[model samples]
Target: MRVSIDSATCQGHGRCYDLAPDLFGEDEEGYAVLTELTADRDVPEGREGDARLAAANCPELAVLVHEQVRA
Candidate 1:
């Protein structure tokens, strides 16, 4: 799975980082930022739940969890 955030909708609630520090982080302004994940945005093994939880708990629904389909 992959994850992303809609900056246009994010309101710096910090729930994404609070609930899933492994998958999310906080910017200098306190907005939710993706942790050190690569540019592909892949959710590391064992962290999919954290990604989904962060997405679900985002009050602004700015966090997004993208399920990747294999060939």
Candidate 2:
């Protein structure tokens, strides 16, 4: 899976970082920033759930995880 944040839609609610710091954080301006595990990168195995949860918990729905379709 792939993780990405729509910075334009972020409200800086901190839910992404608060809910999944391992996969998310804040930039100097306090906007949501994806971590190394998923910062403009692919999701590690077993951590897609966390990414999805973070996206779901985001009130602004700025977090997004593109699920891979296994053939």
Q: How well is each residue in 1-71 modelled by candidate 1, as lDDT tens digits? A: 97899999999999988888867888899987777772468898878888889889999999988888867
Clashing pairs in 2: none
RMSD of 1: 1.3
Weakest 10 consecutive residues, lDDT, candidate 2?
Answer: 34-43
Residue-level lDDT tens digits of model 2 in 1-71? 98899989998999989988989989998999888877666888898888889989999989988999877
- Reference-based lDDT, residue 30, model 2: 90
What TM-score against the true fold does each predicted structure earn? 0.89, 0.90
List the pairs of residues colliding in candidate 1. Answer: none
Model 2 stretches with alpha carbons more than 4 Å out: none
List, in order, the clash count of every candidate structure. 0, 0
TM-score of 2: 0.90
Relative to the unseen true structure, what is the C-alpha lDDT of residue 71 in candidate 1, on a scale of 0 to 100? Answer: 79
Off by over 4 Å in 1: none
